[model samples]
Target: MLHLLPLRTPLAGLGLCVLAGAVHAQDTLTVYGIADMYSEGIWGGGGRVSRLQSGGLSGSRLGFRGRENLGGGLNADFVLETGLNMDEGTYGQNALFGRQSYVGFGYEPAGRILLGRQYSSLYNLSSDFSIFSNLSNGPSSAVVGGFGGYEPVRGSADSSTGNGGPARINNAVKYESPVWGGFRFGVLGGFGEVTNDAGGNRVVDAYARYAQGPVDIAAGYVDDRGGSVTPLAHRRSWIVGAAYSFGSLRLRGAYLAVDDRSVANQDGSGWWLGADYRLGVSLVKIQYVVNRPRYIDNARTEGLGIGYEYSLSKRTTLYTGVSYFRNQDGAGLGRASFSIPSGITSGTDNDLTQWVGGMRFSF
Candidate 1:
């Protein structure tokens, strides 16, 4: 049960005749959220294509986070976050609080352990190293397919129509290790919640990262074990990425791979090269990406993205971005699908190009 209190009392003259303690209280909860939207035009999927979307700047969200120190280096923390559709009042991903819902215990030196729904360790590491946080409609989203560009052990493809792990997971347990001299690690497992043996754990993932001075690096792996006809497919995946920062410029690169038994032994790899320039009122970034998925034949994609961000303040910004992705001819042997909604086939194409523009706000 939750109790709410006011901060006023009327009987102060009678030496505390009113419930002053219940009437006066301090706020401990923090409310925060973001609203992002975009206009997009996709080509080569079939013919002419266009759509309006949220998350051009970032995934739109509304959430509340609260934590209270219980004393003795122990504290309680909880989060209730949900995705939003700026184009409509309805929820974007369908699931209520489709973004995340979790509660956990935290310790200063020991680290944090959380329960319920949350992001996979692989996702945590990837997003940390990504230049755009992998926004759905942002430049990175079009180039690398954001989080969807890789295997689906951690999440689903943004462009797929099939059910996906594009965002968060249910029945998940996550542990985040404390940063020791800029080094930290994380591990997580998700329950399939299936009865009568639908499959095993469904997914398990982990990652380790180090960031000190001007350089940052990380490595991670993810596995998806399931029996669904279209399961993310049991697979082994890994990523290695590094970034170096110099004054106002930062350069980064990453490699990714996935091998699966259920999915025709598909193999793929990708790399990123980019730089960011920060100005007093805005920031500009330019990046390039190349990914190839090996199938019976072979499929490849080369992408380029440029972005600009103008901050109105710390919590709000005006943002715009554009990207071009070329699907190499004769590179259509493997499944290298990436898009919003994840796993859905937009159409057939030997190539695809995209453009997006939008803004983001937080409160």
Candidate 2:
């Protein structure tokens, strides 16, 4: 359920009463969430599995947000959001408020400043410009971002290593600029907070985006310094993406590259192209992605995905999708944003496939 609450305060003193009246008129709070679940059959790693899962099209989440207008075109706002696993009735991201927790202030013409855990700039770019919007299932750019676990840049609670890049940074400070001529940019820095080590597990990310009319373009970069007790490797990644819309059809594409400084020949790159078409209340999407690893000999993976969505209402949707991945030379890539089961390995020249049907409700 979603709720909006208006706050009011009555003060004892007449002067205080006047102050409360001014503030009460500008404060608002809201609670909202999405519930998503899917049934799927996945075939890969020499086995087939059928089950129900959460987050097929989008991750389920609950969140609270509030904003206070401080007058003079300035405002303060905060958000607390948590991911949910609808299937198992569990927390999705391991930590409470793992999806996002931040407080910030914004000026109408200047921009905003925020502090706390938040999404990385690279993730924002990829999600915005991709047809799937980096959903948890089907053919998503997440697979390319985390290919072979060499560059899992998605934010996580773990700050000790950069094995998977932080999708959301912890203990972070961020700044976002106001849009100018359809251009805007943001920067974020995450503090590792390791004792006696200022730079341990640190993260720095930045992104710039421009959108006008039917064209949108964006680029982002992230550098994660991995290490808790001892210094490990540093993971650096960059991405560029673009999207164009014409009538009922939208086309998008993105390219991403990753470099791990700890190991030689561990760099990799990936890219995807996708399109979406809308017909009345129904939508169709198709995407193709490729991943190439520099460390593996002739190791590569390609994925194709097709999806359909029907809108029953503004708040309800029915969706189905299928994805197929072809892996060569021991490349062990699985479905987008999903992990291969433990003890099951995709051997050389193996292939993987997934079929999913689901419903989503938002409030």
lDDT per model vs. reference? 0.63, 0.77
Residue 215 displacement (Å), model 1: 1.8
lDDT tens digits, residues 1-363, model 1?
Answer: 132223244543234324223223332455678888777766555454578887766678888666767788988777788889888877755667767889989888899999877776555655555666555543342233222234432354322322234235567778999999999998877776656754553567688889999989999876666434445456666777788999888877676666656646666566667778897988998877776666524456777778888998887788777766666655232122235322222435556656667777777
Q: Which stretches in model 2 have alpha-carbon errors above 4 Å?
A: 1-3, 9-26, 147-150, 156-165, 331-336, 342-349
lDDT of 2 by residue, 37-156 (tens): 999887876777888888877789998787888999999988889999888898866678978899999998999999987888777777877777776567777767553354444554
Worst 10 residues of 1 by lDDT: 334-343
Error of 1 at 34 (Å): 0.4
Q: Judged by TM-score, which candidate is best?
A: 2
Q: What is the C-alpha RMSD of each candidate to the true structure, in Å?
A: 6.0, 4.2
